[model samples]
Target: MSNRGETVNIAIFTNSYLPFSGGVPTSIKTFKNAAEKLGHTVIVFAPSYPGHKSNGKGVIRIPSVKAMTYAGFYLPVPFSTEITKAFRRYDFDIVHVQHPYLLGETGMKMARKYNIPLVFTYHTMYEQYLHYLPVAESIANPVMRKFTTSFCNHSDLVIAPSEHVKEFLSKRNIETSIKVVPTGIELRPYRKKFRKGSIKRKHRIPQASKLLIYAGRITPEKNLKFLVKCMAKIAKKDPDVMCMLIGKSAEKDHYEYDLKDIVKREGMEDRIMFIGDVPHDKLIDYYKEADLFLFASKTETQGLVILEAMAAGTPVIAVDAPAISEFINGKNGFTVPQNMLKFTAKALSMLRDKKRMKQMSSNALKTAKKHSAENMAKKLIAEFRKVKPTQDEYENMRSLKDLSEIDWSDVIKKIMR
Candidate 1:
């Protein structure tokens, strides 16, 4: 193992990456950028996107086909000669994977081959997103749960983005060592001062309008229809309030149309604006311009955008969920129950109280500072150090006749428990 302060070489395998906008890609990018700055080397293996050119410095693109279930995402081919060549060239101390299947499985195989410690970051609630699978939910849910549990057990370290996720994995009987290291954001951009109302001015919204912003992929799992209902209620109570949904819809599932339709039905066409696909660098300006950040997604493991909004000093009003309830308090923001009436009431109350909002905004900034990229990267490095094998351990692992010795029946028995 490398010395405590010595640089470590990292191999990251993920099903998704740059040019694809989502939490997984964003988290990978953030960690890569921050870790590189700290003199560590990170090589990422990800699916190649059509018409997207990669710089090819540290990222290796695996040939992939577009997934039928997910519109924009591509399914990576498991076997790659390029990845084999990379293993021969780079001496990786640890292999970190972002998903449990496909590319993640490949990562596991490669880690075993090289006798490197394996780390898996459970970035999503697989069961919550099983609707994307062509198989029936009843069959898919339990199978996915079992598969993920087995995968986590195989990993040397399992990273949860929040304490709730860690607890959830424990309940599912994941025997691997679990750590909570949230996807962190660069604090400078959010902390920097920008022209306050630039986003509103660009969208032709009045400067005095109270803007409520929600940023993320527009998919069914996000529960955006509920947010529209909440927005409609808030708009009815305050004529000066407006909402901006700042993301594009999934390629296959254009749920944004449904949201627009709901907005129209609520008679909020003028009040609710669909500002689609803003660049990540420019998103901080929108967050800064917003009076409050609105999030209703119950499926989130970390709700990364909520933290991004808080980083920009925007108080968030989120629906109570395991991950959300961990950070959002009365000081930073409010996390109300899923009930629309209660959620909307808290939002309206917060909007009406200027002094309280200002105090919360200050508290939110402090909260964001605690989750900065540098801090999270240090935590990740520490975990990596704990799991990384020494030279003698690596040699012993390499001497093993077969690395794929896990019993599926045993994994199933544990899942049943």
Candidate 2:
């Protein structure tokens, strides 16, 4: 593990990438860009999107079809002769896979063929995402767990973005080396100079309104319906308090319409605003402009947005979930159960107290400083150095002819179906 200053090449495979914003894409881009700044070469292999340009940036987009159920997500035709050729040319030192399906399996095969270390990041709790599948939960739950266990065991090392994910894997009895490394953001971006009322003025948010921002995907697993109900109750007490739901839905989730319906039914549409997706570069201003960050997702590995919000000196009011338990200490933020009354009471109390919110905001900045992107990149690079493949092992691996003989056309066709 002695490649501190030496240059190394890393090949990353994922089902999603930029033009699509989320924790997975943001985490990969942050670490990849940070590693590159340290003189390492990183290449991303992701699914191609319709009417979107890669514009270079070391990304190789594979041919794919738009996932109708999960809007903005593409299902890639994994069998690509061109990708195989590119793999042979780049000669990456290691392969890092973001998800444990489709592109992940392909990455594993290529890693074995080249006799390189294969590392998998356990980003999502597959059980939580089973809602997206049309299959029955009784059947899909075990299948996903089995598949996840198999994928992690096959890897040289498993990277867990948080202790919560690590604990989830431990319970599954995965017999692989697991490391807990929290994904970080470029703190300076959130700390940069931005006009104080710019976001509110542009969005037509009233100056006297007490702004609360929720920045994440709008999906069922996020427990957003409950949030809408809570906001409706809170609105009756303080009409000046406004709640904004930021970011696009991970899919065109049915929950989105339901949330809107609840808002309309309760006559809280004026108080609650759905300000679609915000650009990543300009996201900081929203965080900085807001008084508090609202996160109710029970299914996050690390909740990168929480850290981003903290970096902007905004305190978070979230549910008592394992994913975000590590970040909150009561001083920095408040964690409550899923109960609407309890959560609303806490949110209202925090908003009413100016002194407490100021202290929490300062504490939030202190917590954010502890998780720097540069430090996270260095930790990943250290792990990469620990998995160097020997020359004889590389020689013993499969040849290009053997790789080509495997029929991936059928596999790609199946996924397309």
Candidate 3:
């Protein structure tokens, strides 16, 4: 623990970090920035990206190689002596890990060695992502579930991004204390004024076009094919409506090619535009410029992009899932089942109604205000304090023998089996 009053030293371990604009990286950056503003030290231990260099202040990059299965992601070489030496220097009060494998296992070992609390955030629905593996779904799904569940059970505390995610972990028989802490958004950027039609002008989209947008990684698990189908249906009714997808494919699964093929088959290439990976600051403006924010992902734990769109005073029309249902209601946005007919109908209805759209836009902004980054940081800090070790316990832990060497490959193989 830090000598400073009410402040604690935090060590965050994540497989992914900056230069990757996925939910896990975004969530880690959001919490780290907000927590630092509230007077705490956060050191991120993440995989090294190819050309990206860390400032080497709060962030520690580990040696890694590019993953063959997943694009724009690196697999950490977990047995680095430099990382071990650097980790021993910090008197971390609690260890927070964003994933349950690779770096996550290293975090668990470090926490055990130091006798600090191991806190795991249930970020992704891991089983849904088994398509990345070469193994069959039937074989991979059970292994993934077991691997993640065991990690959660070992952790002293587990953080779920939403109440629905908490329920999910509980059902998995995760025998650890779970807390709901949705990744917070910085509201200041959303409040700033930006010129209207700037995005349309830049993209050569017509100024009078009704813009619908989706932001996140273009991957298989995101259910982007359904979104393309919905856009095709909407285009038939409204000639002026255009859908802009603002993200790049972060996986080598060729899902982007599949989506483009569908768009071509439907003969709606002009109606749908793929605007890959907008910077976070600029993405807010894109969200604000859109008339509606469309999401079709069924596997999000707590769709952070949905909240971002809401922050920009844009109403969402998302496929109904546990996390999506919590935020998207009749007041702020509409939630529909996975049915394409129902989703397109809701989207078309919202676009045609001016008065109702205005009311929902106002409601969306109000909803976003309640989820400010500061509030979520405070909640996260509270959770850290709850699991922090006592002074005597900390002292005793330090006196204990050093952690033994581990064969990571063997451990991983055992877990997979």
lDDT of 3: 0.84
- Badly placed stretches (over 4 Å) of model 1 are 191-193, 251-254, 388-417
TM-scores for every predicted model: 0.92, 0.92, 0.91
Q: Which candidate order results from sorting by lDDT in descending order? A: 1, 3, 2
Residue 147 accuracy (lDDT) in model 2: 72
Task: Give the alpha carbon lDDT tens digit for every residue of 1-417 in model 1.
Answer: 577999999999998998888999989999998999999999999989999996467999988776666667776776789899998999999899999777787888888778899999999999988776655789777777877887787788999999999999999888789999998888877656698778888999899999998999888888899998999999999999999898877743357778888899999999998888888989889999999999999988999999899898999999999899888988999998889999999999999999999999999999999999999999999899889532333224331213333332333333333
lDDT of 3 by residue, 1-417 (tens): 333357878889898998777889888888888889988889998988988875456988888766666777777767777657766787788899999878897887788778788889999998888776656789768767777777787778899999999998889887779999999988877778799999899999899999999998898778999998999899878999998888989653478888989899999999998888888999998999999999989899999999999999999999999998998879999999999999999999999999999999999998888888888988888888877532233224321212212244643443344
- Count of backbone clashes for each model? 0, 0, 0
User: By lDDT, is 1 or 2 better?
Assistant: 1
Highest lDDT: which candidate? 1
Q: Model 3, residue 30: what's the lDDT?
A: 84
The TM-score, computed over Cα atoms with residue i paired to residue i, of candidate 1 is: 0.92
After aligning candidate 3 to the native by TM-score, how far in Å is the CA of 379 from where it should be? 0.3
lDDT (Cα, tens digit) per residue for candidate 2, span 1-417: 336678888989998888788888899899988889898988988988888885368888888876655768777777788678878788688899998777887888788788788989999988988766655778778777777786787788899999989988998878879999888777767756799989889878788888888988888888898888888887788888888898788654466778889999999888899889888888888899899888888888988999999999999889889978888889989889999999999999999999999999999998988888888998888888887543433334343223432243543444356
Q: How many backbone clashes does candidate 2 have?
A: 0
